[model samples]
Structures are given as C-alpha cells and as structure tokens.
Target chain A: MSINEKDELLYNMENRDVETPQPRVKRGGVHRPFLFGFATALCLVYLMDLGFEAYKFATLRETVQVASGELQTSWPPPPPYTEVARVARYVVHISDWASLATISTAAPIKGFPFANTASVSDGPVGLSSGTPYFYISNLDFTGKDLLTDARTTVSLSEAQSDYCHTSGFDPEDPRCARILLSGSIVEVKNGTEEATFARTALFSRHPVMKTWPIGHHFFFAKLNISHIYVLDFFGGASDVSVQDYYKATPFP
Target chain B: MSINEKDELLYNMENRDVETPQPRVKRGGVHRPFLFGFATALCLVYLMDLGFEAYKFATLRETVQVASGELQTSWPPPPPYTEVARVARYVVHISDWASLATISTAAPIKGFPFANTASVSDGPVGLSSGTPYFYISNLDFTGKDLLTDARTTVSLSEAQSDYCHTSGFDPEDPRCARILLSGSIVEVKNGTEEATFARTALFSRHPVMKTWPIGHHFFFAKLNISHIYVLDFFGGASDVSVQDYYKATPFP
Candidate 1:
C-alpha cells in the first residue's frame, strides 16, 4: 500500500469509529476491511446454507428439488405502494425486463394475445423517464408482431424485482404491486431526439443490445403511456394517470 | 415406542444404508432428528446470509438496492432447453404463479392489452396436464378483462424459477427460457371433470387460494392452449405444438 493509504488505514483502525462522521471523500477508502469481512461472512453463511439444502435434498424423494430463486437485484429503492405514480415509475426504472403482450400477426393466431418476454428500459441509468423502450429485430417474432400490430402493452411485476421477494409477498398477491403500460408501441422516429434517448436508454440497461447483429434490422420501439394500470393494493386495479406516471420521480 | 417402530429406526440409523432403499410403507416416520438438524442448519445459514445482505445495504449509497430474489423452488428437475415441450411443461409446473395478460374492458383503456399477475396451476399435484388454470374474482380486473376477451396469454419465465439463478443466467438471457401460451381463456364449467382437476391443481400448489374471499365472485379459468412459443435456446424462439407440449411430461 502507498504510504498515505497505509497511514490512513492505520489511523482508521486505531479509531475503529463509524461515528467519526468523516467527509464523504475520506469515507470511500475507510472501513473497507469491515466491509470485506462482512461480505465474506455472508458468503460463507450462504454457502453453508446451500450445503444444508443439498443434504436435505439427498434425503427427500428422488425428485429435483428446485433451489430458492431470488430475483436479480438492481439499483433504486421502491416507492411505497400507496404512491401509485411513484411506484409505477420505480418498477419501470429498476426492472430491465418485462413481458410485452402484443396482438398476434400470424395466420390462425391473428387477434390472439401474444405475450413475449422482452428486455426494457424507461431511460438512461440514473435518469428514468417512466417510458418503456425496446430494441427489436425483424428476425425476432416480437418485432414481427410489433410491425403488424403496433398496439401493445408492456407489463412489469414486482416479481421481476427484489421488492416482492424480500418483503415475502407472493408475486400473485395484489399487494405485491404490478404495472402495465398500454398504448401503441410505435418506433421512435429515426433521427429524432426521442430515438436517440431511447437508444441510450435501452443500450445502457441492456448492454448486449449494443453488440447485437446489425444485419438483423434493429429498431427502437417505445410504449407511449396513453394508459396505465397500477395494481398496488388489495382493492383491485386502479387507474394511474399517464401524467402522474411520467411525472413521478423514481430517484427521489 | 412400539417394537416395530423402534426396530425400524434402529435398523435405519445403524445401517445408514441408503442403497437398499425400501418401499413407501416404511416411509411414514424415520430419521427425524437428522432431518431436523439438516433443516435447522440450513435455516441458520440462510438467516446469516440474509443478515449479511442487510449489512451490505447499510454501507452502500442510500438507493433502493433490490434484494437478490430467489424463486420458490419445487421438485422433478427441469428439462433440457433442447426439449421445448418438456422444458415448457417443467417451467409451468414448477412456477406456482405467472403474469396473465388479457384485453381490458374498462371504458378508458378498453381494448388495450392489460396484464395482471396471477396464481395458476396446470393439473393436480402429480397429474400435470400442461394446461394453466386460474382462480379469479369477478370483483377484480382480471376476471372482468377475461369476460370481455377470453383471448389471453399466460406468460411463464424460468426467471420466476430457481433454475435460471442457479445456472447463473440472466432472466433476459435466452438460455434462461421463457414460454408464452397464446389462446382463449375460458371458465372451467363447475362440476365438470376438468373443473375438478383444475381445482385440485390450483389448490394443491397455491393452498392459500382456497381461503380467498368467497364474496369476490371467484371462479376458475383455464387457457385453451392454441399456440405455444418456447424461447429456451440462443438462436431464437421456436414454436411448440400444443399436442407436444401436453404430451411431454415434466417428470421425464
């Protein structure tokens, strides 16, 4: 370690203080050992837990016992369910993926509701616009369906989030909270400011999209939040105004 | 203790012989402490891991750090992604709940695609028929939406499962596997054999469904699978015939 870093570490170790209330700049390097130790302990506990689970599996009937599935976590805290607008924005902000339901364009299945899992984003990282955007390729069925029928709704669940699981709420439970954005999913007009914003929003959240084959005819489609359904409580679904949905600040 | 019970425990404990593997008749009660100890250890480890997660939260920036969401796991292992039919059935059978999408009936958003999260089941616990059934309330939006438009899709993702997380796959990753069954959803006529099977399926997996408010005008609904879209591989999504989907058993 550098002499300066070594001196800083020694001083912090001697003080052993969280209450010292150091400035934010100094805070970054300090207490790293405590963080490391804490993380290590946690991982050890998780590993042991995994071992114990395996042992239990060995004793159970010879069936594949599924392990506990926790959702992939992301940044930004969820808003209180009572704040429908904010919660709707929060869900759309943190969830990088959702099910996009579109009208079927193929023969025999025409007019039927076709649900496809899709990667999505509302805006750039650290900036959420409460509008969902998608990168689609004609090579994909969702893109085909979108082109034929622009009407679509992108539904996001707290099931796609850590909020529901951490709070021990069943994804199906009304209290778990879900949001559906209904409107025409039109391609962002090429070369428009919206298209630029959409591309940044999608590529930032789904980095792989940037590397996707260009020959596939990729285009950006966004859900114009003409209608919003927010299921945040037990009384059934409530209508969330598009204005409020877009206005609610997820970061705050 | 009865002589038979004591002898059985003595033999099993002393032998610790798993190779012989006896019949179900002797399965009622045995090696409970070993089971209990195993369970307790697992629980402790899980709690410590949870504690560790919480501690990490304390040190991070005050953003809503989504928790690591672990999907609820069950048995009878998942099928290979190559077996579209088997994989589809496995995802549905193991996932106790999924998001159901339907056409909305409300005046403002009427005709717009509306999505709702729901608890669903295909068949009785051991008799999965690969048909999704739902217990709905007329008092809720989903039932109303269904009434207006039975054309709906029930979307299931291995993301709602432990499979993806265990395999270290992102939910958005094609390898994570997602299934979309598009068709008409209809009310399973009460007193029919199918209704009976549907109830057993729904209740067995989601026991709490049995106790939901009766006054909510709850009834059973099942998706008449007409088209199946299985995305379990990297190349792209492929169509799975409903027949193959139903014929492919999850256990196999």
Candidate 2:
C-alpha cells in the first residue's frame, strides 16, 4: 500500500476497540491467519483461567470435607533454635507470605527502600527448595524497583506459620525465629522451565494469584540469596552461612 | 595487695550466691553504701515487676468481667476502604507489627535492601496520629541499616488486622488495603515529646517492648514520611498528598 493508504489504515485500527470488530479489517490488506492465531490465544487463556477456578473449587470442597471431621491442621515444623540452617530452610518453606523489601527508584524518592506484602513460596506444598519465588506485575512499584536495583531482601518470620502462634511464641521473641537475607533478584524469562516451576510454587500456596488481572503483565522473579541472618536466640543472630542455607533440609 | 589476695577476693565473690550475706563485702575493698544502693535498686525493680504483674492480673479480670456481657470487642476501625486517610491511619494504629525495609549498610551486605519484622504503632490506643513509630535496638540489623541509610520504607497490609479476615477479604485483594511509604528514619531523642509519644504508642500496642532486654540499647525511631501510596480499591493507588496524609482526621 502507498504511504497515505497505510496511514489511513493505521488510524482506523488504532481508534477501533475490540468490540467494534471491522468486517472490512482485511480490506486494508491485513492477513487473515495472523488475526486467527491472536484470537485463538485469547480463547485458550480464558479457558485456562476457568480450569484454574474449577480446580480451586474442587480443592476447597475437599478441604471443607476434611475440616468437618477434624478441626486440627497437620503443622510440621522444627523446634525454634534447633539448628540455624535447618530452621531457616523450614521457615522459608512453610510461610505463605512475606514482605519483599527493595531499593526504590521512583521519582523524587529514589534509592529509598520499599516493601510490599507479597505472596511467596520456595517450592510447591511439602517440597522445600530454599529459594523464594514471586509472581509480580510491573505496574507495582516493587516490580519497577527491582528493575533498577535487583538487590532485594526477603524476610520471613516463623510467626507466619501456625506452629509458632499455637506454641505461644510471640513474634518479637527471638525463640520464634526470623530469617533475613540479601539476594539478587532476576526475572524468569517467559516460556522456561524455571518460570513454570515458579508459577507452580506460587499458585499452589496462593491460588488467588492465578486470578489477578492479566492486564498487569505479571512475571515470575526469583531471589538468588548470598547472605542469611537468622535470629533464634537471645545472645545474637544465628551463624548461618549461605552455603549452609541452601543445602539444609526443611525436615529432620 | 598481693595477686593471691586479689584472686581470693574474686573467688569468694563468685562462689557466694545472692542468698549469702557477706558480713564484710567491704573487706575486699569494695565500698559499703555502693553495694547497698545497688541491692536496693534491684529490689525496687523486682517490686515494680510484681506490681506490673498485679496490674495485668487485675486488667485480665476486668476484661473477663466485661466479656460476660459482650461477644464482640469494642474495636472501632473504620470500615475497610471507607476513606483513604482514615483507613491508612487505622491500619498503622491497629497493626502491632509491620516489615520495616531499609537500605542495608552492614558489613558484607552493604547497600542492599533489608527487611525486618518489626513491631510498630502510630499512636497510643484510640488516638491515631497517621505516623508509624518503632522501638528498635541498635544491635538488630534493621537498626544498624537505618543508622547508615536513614531512608526507609514501611509497608503495611490490612491482613495484619482482623478486619480483613472477618470480612472475607483476602490479604492480596485491593479491597483489603495496603500502605507503602518512603521516608527518613530518625532516632527520637530521649526526653523529647516525640520520644515519649513513640514509647507510649509502641508500648501500648506491643506490651512486650517494655520487657525486652535493656542491654540491646533500644531507641525510639519514627519515619518522617515524604510519600504515601495507598491501595484501597481496584483502579490504582489513591492520590494521598503528604499534607493530607498528616492532617487528615482519623475518624469523625
């Protein structure tokens, strides 16, 4: 097409909403196969969302059935201050959510720290990997902050788990155990095995994550930790080397 | 004095428990009135502890007396998402703990972001100041981080409050509300009105703060917030100006 015709076609496409489908769209010489593929992808995404909702419903039904019979939940966690590496790994595994702190790069408040209550998991239920994953959107300040400075911290407290609350350990007490780490945050490229694993780890613990608005452009990011500082006793923070953090098992 | 005499004196002091009354504690050349004054101070402190225990016992009895007549607590938080300033203030006031995010400057992890699970309060009970205060010990990583880089962020979620859990709002939902702030963390000088306010605000919410070890060199700190971002509803963060944030009345 000539330049004038191309400009006219682009203007029409830009102004038109999806609901205002143009029967004459192909008249601008746009190909049919491209539109067909785009439409198919959209339908598949919708179907996947529906499938996820159905799965959650079934899971909730099973949980309710189980709860009616027994009110107690099977909480398995190591005693606080037992061993530094082991406790750190166990807290990371069982805690469903934590605040992710990052250095801000936003206008006028740049370089300050920012934190958000985040849905996080190291691996799927009953499987501990010692690495926390996040599914986040760029629309959020945290996502933008990570892009500018990927040095991040994920701090988890055993108070987040029912075991601590039930055992009468107050959150501020050192005996409740807390883990703080400094790490590098990196985005998981779409269409990769790590991305898949990240999604599974997050969604299994926080099923609502699967239903967040798609327009937000959610992506998975993982923190590769270099330092681990834990507090589980009165004297001082526990001596947990990064080498010990990753290799330690979540359970005895 | 001979070295053996000095050693003997030290051994006697160490071997004698608190129950043993030394007829000649001054025989080792220790002053008499100094030791007596110290013992008197210790006894006064113990008596004060007993008084506090009695006060708590009476308070518990009063609460039990009141509970017989009412099934609900007199919690007076504004309905979630009612007004931006009011809700933000309420969350900060009612939340006993939040994650304090600071730019790390500690050795081996300098310049990275660090988060610590912190106990916080905005004001003494029922009087919301719309500013969060922290009682922190310099021995903790967060305290050290803030000292080097006072720029900090405090993120709070309504999930920390019973409002969300009772109303069936998920912690991650926008309706559950969240607050993000960037500010400078400064030590509240002792004997200042703000320091008194900080202590009152903190101790009233986190009663355990009053009992934390004194050797840790705890201090009162408050975030002089420059920016406030609040998410109380679906579209995006509410446009809450700093002046509005400070002056906004907590409730009618």
Candidate 3:
C-alpha cells in the first residue's frame, strides 16, 4: 500500500467503534483449554488473608486471658499474729558536760547527794520513747553534740550502784535493757496541734519537765526512727512491767 | 547507832533546812591538778554536731541545684519549614484479563479460523504515578493474596518504556525507579472526611479513578523503601521543567 493509503487506514481504524464477535475452537484442544491462572491467584490471596486474621485473633485472646489471671490473684486477707509481747529499755551515757557525773539513774533524784551540786546541775535526760525526747539548753555542749552526731550508744544497767549488794537492789544481778539509735538530726517545728498534747504528757510523767524551763528553743526535732534493740534483763520473770514500760512508742 | 536512834536522825535530816558549805583545796598541790574530762566531752560533742549539720546542708544544696539546672535548660525554639518534601517510589505487579474475539481486518472471512481469546469481560488494569494504587474486586484471587501476606515484589525492566519517552518527558532516557514494599495490608474507609481529601488528590493526578467503582478493595500499608540503584542513562541531565514551571510566575 502507498504511504498515504497506510496513514489513511490507521486513522480509520483508530476512529472505528464496531463490535467484534466471539471466536470458536475445537473441543479439548490447547486453544480451548481452561486457564487456572486467575483461580490460583485468587486462592493464594484469600488463604493469606485468612491466616493473618487467625493469628491476630489468637494473640488478642492470649493477652486478655493473662490479664484476667493476674487480676484474680491480686487480692487476699492478711496473716495472723502469734508472737506479741512487751519490752522495757533504757540508754545511759557519761554526761558530756560533766564526764564525772554519769546518767546512773533515769528515775527522779529526790534530793540525792549529787542532785544540785556545782559539778552536777540538772542535766538533760532522754525518755524511753521509740524516738527519744530530751530537754536541752542552747548553751550546753551535750545538746550541741546530739544535734551533730545523732547516732550514738548510751549504756544501761539495772543495778543502782557499782556495788550490787546495796540494799533494796535485786540479788540475782539481772541484765538491763540497752539500745543505740542511728539517724540524722533534723529540726522540725512544734506547730502541730499534737505538740501541746505531747508537752502535757511530758510534764505529768517526767520530774525534769516540771523542774526546768524547756519552751524557749526555736526548733524541736522530729527524729526519723530507723531501728531498735531491747536487751531483756529478767527474761520472762517480770514480763508485765518490762513490756509496758520499755516499749518505744512511735511519735505522731 | 541503834535502830530507834537512826530513825530519829533520818526524820531530823529530812526536816532540816541547813545549807551545805563549799570545800576549799590548795591550788598548787598534786591533788589540785586540772581535770580534762569536762573539756574533752564538750569538744567531742561540739565537733559531732557540726559534722552532721555540714552533711545535711551539703545534700540539700546539691538537690536544689540539680532541680534548678533542669528547669533552666528546658526551653528553646522550633523550625521554619511548613510542607516537608518526602519522595516515595514503589513497584507493583499487574495482570490484565483478555478475551478471544475475531473480526475482518481487511476482507471478509471465507473459512473457519481459530483465535486465541483473553478473558477481559470484567477485570482491572493497574497504573502508577509515583506510587502504584491497586483497584480490584472482592472476588479476585490476587486481591485475596494481597490481603493475606501483603508482601510482594515487582520485576522491572532496565530499558525505558514508551511512557518515559513522551514529548514533555524531562529526562530523555530515564532509568525507571524500582522498589519492593513488603508489609501487612489494612483496609481504610474512603467515605470519611480525611479519606475524601486523600482520594481527591490521588484521583486528580490519575484518570483511572473514573473507571474504578467506589468502595472497592485497596491496600493500605507501611512500606519499606529499599534496593535503590541510580543509572546515568540520561547523561547526568537535570530536569528543570517543574522548576521552570514554578519559577515562571513572579512572586505575589
């Protein structure tokens, strides 16, 4: 065909919109064979989606079951107590102001020979509360030392004197409760309502509170309680008095 | 003394109002040597209290300084870019359905002749701009497979096709960008407002949206863009059509 004719034919074909009829082929021949490409592709894609869905469902179910199990075992009642008893304790030390004057007794002096002499004025005394409470003057060296190194041991003895054979003393030579407290000394305010109640209890129970002035200090300490050790002298023989009097009660 | 005499003496002593006199000792004698107990106790106590106070003060100072430093360093400025440019390219596999049909090319048919027909009654055609977007029916096997594994690779040609040789194509012989994205497939709803915006942008760039039905299946994936190979097919030519088009107009 001529070049112009070929160009004309291409233009006619491009613009045509005629419908074509279906073709026929012999039965069971290669031309008429069934194509499995589309079916196989469809099956593979469907199977993959199903597998992913199944995996996701299983993982979610397991997580839920584990959370339920944890919730079930979290709540129960507390255990019973079988070993409860009382204990008495005390701490003694060589008075820092007057080394010769020792904390020989924690009880009231009642005009003893060493009560108010030049070498022995009324010294600050610590009570047997879980956290110790004591009176101190801003001028005393012992008070300053306690504020610095709050961790110190005080000695204790049941015997009233070095000679155990003194009258009105026990003959069996029983052991005495001794303890040491180790913690930092912090200054806290006495602004809480409970402070007044604590002061009243101190005045009624301690002779020193009644005898000496103790309300002038700017800061009082709220000690952090760490540990406690009680050495029982008479064991179970004097259980009632020892337990009731010596147990350290925590401050409010 | 007899018991009667001792009792009388004790009663008299208790009621006595007599004051005790101070004792005097010689200053230069060995018995009058200076005592160091009081001085030593005071020194020790004072040193301890001072040490504890120093420690507490140092710790508190350190904590406060650290917190202040953190607070100071936490404020600054941000960046100035508005629309960040991200280039994403991918490869996709495509399958076209064909049907057997016959018609006269130049003259009328004289005898029966066989023709190979492709099943193209109801199928899809794949296309791409920067990323390939699939449009398939729910019953298609390829669609099912994509939902299942969602992992696939496209075998691309190294030679440029007719699409890349268009009249306005900037790079004369461009090396096609090929990438394989393997990830789990998710179906997103196109009826929502966010989907509507995304669909409009996609459809505006490609005319295939007019042929595909709405709400048909499509894959949403987290694609891994990798295996990049750059070829100097266009002799390192830089395409400046986009830049020229953008710079043709003066700034407002």
Stronger candidate by lDDT (2 vs 3): 2
| Of 1 and 3, the candidate ranking higher by DockQ | 1
Candidate 1 wrongly placed segments (more than 4 Å): A1-72, A189-193, B1-71, B75-77, B124-127, B165-170
Runs in model 3 deviating more than 4 A are A1-85, A89-129, A154-157, A160-174, A207-223, A233-252, B1-252
Expressed as tens digits, the lDDT of each residue in A2-73 for candidate 2 is 999999889878877664966632445643433454455456656876999999866543331100011212
**lDDT (10s digit) by residue, model 3, range B34-131:** 12323343455568769989998665433211001001111111111111111111112111111111111211211111111111101112222222
TM-score of each: 0.69, 0.68, 0.21
> Which scores higher on DockQ, 2 or 3?
2
Tens digit of per-residue lDDT, candidate 1, span B170-252: 56678878888888888889999988888888776666676778788788888888888888988887899988987898876
- Residue B46's lDDT within candidate 1 is 77
Residues A115-208, candidate 1: write the lDDT tens digits: 7778788887668888888887777767888777777778888776545555556667777778888888878889999999998987766666
Superposed by TM-score, candidate 3 places the C-alpha of residue B235 at a distance from the truth, in angstroms, of: 99
Calculate DockQ per candidate and list them. Answer: 0.16, 0.13, 0.00
Evaluate model 3 with DockQ and give the value.
0.00
- Model 3 chain A weakest lDDT span, ten residues long: A66-75
Q: Local error of candidate 3 at A32, Å?
A: 99
* RMSD to the hidden true structure, all candidates: 23.9, 39.9, 52.6
For TM-score, the strongest prediction is: 1
